[model samples]
Target: MPISSAMAVKASSRINSMFRILWLSAIVGMLAACGSVPLPPEPPIPTAPSAPRGAPPLATPEDGAPLPPARIQGRTRWQPVRWAELPGFTDDALNEAWNAWIRGCERPVPALARLCPEVRQLSIGTPEEQRAWMMQRLQPYRVEPLAGNESLLTGYYEPQLDASRMPTAAQQVPLYRPPADLATRRPWYSRQDIDTAPQARAALRGREIAYVADPLDALALQIQGSGRLRITEADGRVSNVRLAFAGSNEQPYRSVGGWLLQQGATRDASWPGIKAWARANPQRLNELLWSNPRVTFFREEPLSEFDAAFGPRGAQGVALTPGRSVAIEKDSLPYGTPLWLSSPGPLLNLNRLVFAQDTGTAIVGPLRADYFVGWGDQAGEVAGRLKQPLALWVLWPR
Candidate 1:
């Protein structure tokens, strides 16, 4: 029998409600399993004092006095959570859980609230607890999820001491090599063996694609062999752009589907310029200029190596680390973070020191990090050899 439209809609709604409940239950369970630390007893909320018979009204902001308006401009709209919303969690338990989470957070609650007004209405037990709860709830949103083993999603669970322990030279050794099957990986371009324009264009046919720039020279490096370009406009209109590799000699560029608009010719690689150019070129632009590389890039060499190689000139003829090694950037994990890196083979085993001090033209995504291995052959070798899992820890500042 065919189901009625009304019945289908009702079933969908019920399913959505159940899904929300399940998600909420999972979050609560995870928090419970983590175990909340005990907090000092909160002082009782004060009752409003009865007004004296002749009490004057509060002064208005418009008066000569310096009092500001009671309601500030550009305030966020968030309402307090109702008691019924948190069914099973006790107020004290919730408060303790929130505080434990907040104490470890880099950004405190009030600062976070200014940025994310949605947190204002969330129930956090008492007024003091509100800030802590808000911080805990917001942590998940700030982290950009990466595609990797699900275990990576939880990150390193153990608490690290807040001190800068320069890894002793002895302790800094490669840990493991990537499996042989994964070790021989090459860049998409290298893998395809496409070095010419005709070959690149032919390879890109009917596939989505993008490009990255060399850190030092900022040269347009084509990332070929993806399926179809998905160009999303500011208005959320998604259009398919054609990917065309301009060959080794021809500058790699992006091509929109429509005729080139006047704005297309003038659009530089900047975000606004790219959008405007995309709008104008509609179809003529050769390639999207700002696309990031998909490979797991890292800023190469440990801080010790950097200092020994470049710090205050120990040797005159020794080449200083180029942007690839000295200026590579990590994700928001911050500079000076220690990462336990493993790649294929016994030779590659070592825990290396990395700082999140630099950013690269191609390193934008969360799971991604770019290692500068000094330019030319060294950089190429390191870039080519970087296809393995890396465990990272932000050495907390003392």
Candidate 2:
């Protein structure tokens, strides 16, 4: 199953290349600069109100004077809790999550930087030792929405595709890099505009980085904001490379899947559903692709063995660990924060320690999260259909 393009959301801005070039350097040496990648696209869902479901009225004073607001961050009220309150706290494989934590230590926040040495040492520590250290140094806070306990957990992944350096009869659809005049244009040529307008096409004429067979394939690459492109060059050389998000055309993103549903075109709005619709109604394929006005541009990067092991660098400027890195709403949880995620899943039940290493536009709210499921087809299958109830507890420094 393929996810909807709407799942694509902006990641952090690009950091320096030092990390890539010297990836094997000590964790501290690897902290050169931060870079950006886009969050995988999931279909758009209804936006929940930023406000909590219902907040209790402020306590009145004896003199009928309203009490000042309680100190809090974002739209959440952090309720402190005991470590035992977290379900499956002792069951998670702490060592499995240590890799993500160590990555965070590469460029740790002021509060957590001091703990880097300990975090690294504990990478191979026993679960009991790690658990004890956490309990000794961190406080757990239940992340509560102001109005309600409603929370959502979704999944996202990097897409992989076969591509070519030059356009071929089979691989005619082009994936482009940003145009020279992109910044000057308030909103660059749209998906439809680029397809139909000569001038718009001219701007991107020499900017094609690679070409793939299906238009939807190109769109998926754009929607994911980044992907693995196994490219066969014109000279008969083949290599696997990463296409990282460079920029968007500034046009607002619209959900083509949602459009299909609204138009009564199909009940299945997943990527597979969209593909089926495209196949059945080739004449309307352009109309479907053009429903989303935004266009994402990407730059190519060499995918090294080390890089291949992890997903693209997230908003936190570190490579994301599969099942261990989660895209969060930055307003509610800062990057690098450790979290206990418990979800009663109809697809997959997850109770583990994950990190707030990325953020997505759709991954908004105090409790909402998008789990990074890694790359390739298997991961895409999980990301495409994962939507379940969620609960989170943030482990903060004591």
Candidate 3:
């Protein structure tokens, strides 16, 4: 199903590549200069790794009492739990989660910022060491859905698509940059109107960075809000470019799957299911698309070696570590909070430590969350099939 009608928040560049490059160059130059004359070795001071391109420095925790009891609304009741209550805590690859936790510090939760120095030290440690650190520094609190014990967990991913720099007969669907009046306009022309209206077409003139063959593929990027565009140039050289979120047409989001279900067109609403219906009824594709008035816009970011590793930056403003990062309603669970999320077998046996690093228009409630499996088709498959019951235990500061 689609996400909520809640505004799909957009983000801009947080990382400055030129700055990182210049800093690294200066460091290299200094090291080269020092090589001529050997000096007494200095004790190693653990240097904090350069953070993701644009993320802000971790804020120093306020000098005060503990965070006012994290009482969040939307059906929440925190039940105190011990580290022993966390399922698969010992078995989890806390090392993988350590990297994620580190990225999270770039946008650390106010309460957790003070502990980042200790969290930083765990990066090179073994999983057992990481687990011990977590146990000693954090307290687990099981968040119950005051309504019941059960809650829903779904998934989302970064989708990759083949595209072209210029429009052709085969690649006519255009992916646009944000129009100038996007903010001034209440609701810009929708997906349908953008194609049909002359004024709308004029508004977005000369802004297309690439064109694709499938509208659904384009729609996938819009829904995900960010993606990679593998551009096949006229010379046959292919280059990958990232489409970071620029803005969106100020219209409410409506899930086409929900429209299909409501219209009695399909029961299976997964991405594959939706694609199947699109293929079967090609003529109604526009009808399905127009159901959602919202149109997401993007700006091309030069894909770098750094980008090749992690998924897009989430609402928390940090590059997400795939498989170890998850999005929950930020209002319910503060950003950068560590969590133990588990699901039953035969569906998703997700018993692991995940950082709450992102949020979604639809992700609300104390127990609800969306697992970020990773990027590409395999990740998409997992995300599409993941609508299962879940349990959560937030590891808070003691």
Candidate 4:
């Protein structure tokens, strides 16, 4: 939804008004024809199209809500740039991004729906041809947030962990399902409340979906939203199943890593850092967990070999494509929007075409994005370590 420009909006308002008037005039004209009744005086000419090339670069209406100004920046702004400005535009494989783009097409936003056919037709093109097609059909808009020249780029992934079907002495921690009273109450319970309050525990009794041996592992799954659980049942059979997002307690989220920083306990504010702290202060683990009031609940999904390669469903209801799918502020960059990203040496892959396919609560503000690394421990390792500055350019329809 790369916010609309002022000219486009003014144009759209006039268009809407014109449509209404036409509808009304057609009704009145039919009546006049039948009884010789004079038509109402003609409405003043529709707002004149901008003179001196006054029209906005584009005037297409968006999907649902009226979008904010896109051509200009307030908190986050887009400025037109040439495709040549994009680093590795031709060098990168557009095919690598094609699948992610197709995933977005599974549920295209209205403004992007028209482009779906063309996207499907071009999916099989060579990287060079695809590059040329993008250069011709899309405009590169350099994005910058109001406060800074660049925004932070972080990573997140699906975690794989060992699990048990039921609570055991060795595997005592529990993963819960939403309770029936969840619908009846607002902000049902906080993380601290769930751990310490008898009432909260009572509410969640008999709702365990699975149990884990490590408390931190459970928290990690909650923070990541979803993951794959390798279950080891009493019968000695093990199978991998996905724990997808079900619901969350209606409580405000506080980053445990952020809380650690405020207490002057750390500088490296990543998952690994949190785990390191947990290892050293084993007794105070609950204190750290309680710092984050919000708690997330999940439901188990069967994972097939094919499904294991992709990520859990995103806000757009499409499985996230590792390395290519990114979570952006939909109000700023609509899902399915293609972005040309450039980062300094510190980032793993500096430049690539990433599709906006997912979103997260922590991923707020303009020009901000979270890169999905993929599933398993390698992905998690990369995600936890990422904290770098990034530059982004949206490849919007020309």
Question: Best by lDDT, which number?
Answer: 2
Local distance difference test, candidate 1: 0.28
Q: Which candidate do you rate higher for lDDT, 1 or 4?
A: 4
Q: Residues 1-398, candidate 1, lDDT per residue (tens digit)?
A: 23233332333233222323333344443343242233233323222233356663222111232321221111111122221122221222333223222222212223321321222122223433342232222221112234432111111000101111122232221111121222333333321122234654454343322222211111212221111223333355644332222223122233221122333455343323444555665453324322322222111122233233321110111122222112222334433222222222332432333323334343434444444333233344443344343333222211
Q: What does candidate 2's lDDT look like per residue over 1-398, in tens digits?
A: 12121211100011111113222343533332123222223223212123233652222111123323333558788777656578887678887888888788766667766666556555545565566567555777888888667799988889999999998889999989999999999888888899999999999989999999988877776776789999999899999999888999988888788899999999998777788899999999889989998889999999999799899988988889999999998988889999989998888889899999988656767789999999988887788778899999888876
Find the candidate with the highest TM-score and give its number. 2
lDDT of 3: 0.75
Residue 377 lDDT (model 2) = 81
Score residue 159 of candidate 3 by CA lDDT. Answer: 87
What's the CA RMSD of model 3 in angstroms?
12.4
C-alpha-based local distance difference test score of model 2 = 0.76
The TM-score-based order of candidates, best leading, equals: 2, 3, 4, 1
Query: Which of 1 and 2 is the better model by TM-score?
Result: 2
Clashing residue pairs in candidate 3 are: 14-54, 15-53, 15-54
Off by over 4 Å in 4: 1-75, 146-150
lDDT of 1 at 346: 30
Judge candidate 4 against the unseen true structure and give its global Cα lDDT, from 0 to 1: 0.75
Candidate 1: worst-modelled 10 consecutive residues by lDDT: 153-162
Taking all chains together, each candidate's TM-score versus the true structure is: 0.23, 0.81, 0.81, 0.79
Candidate 1, residue 93: CA error in Å? 46
In candidate 3, stretches whose alpha carbon ends up further than 4 angstroms from where it belongs are: 1-75, 146-150
Better model by TM-score: candidate 1 vs candidate 4: 4
Model 1 ranges off by over 4 Å: 1-308, 311-331, 336-347
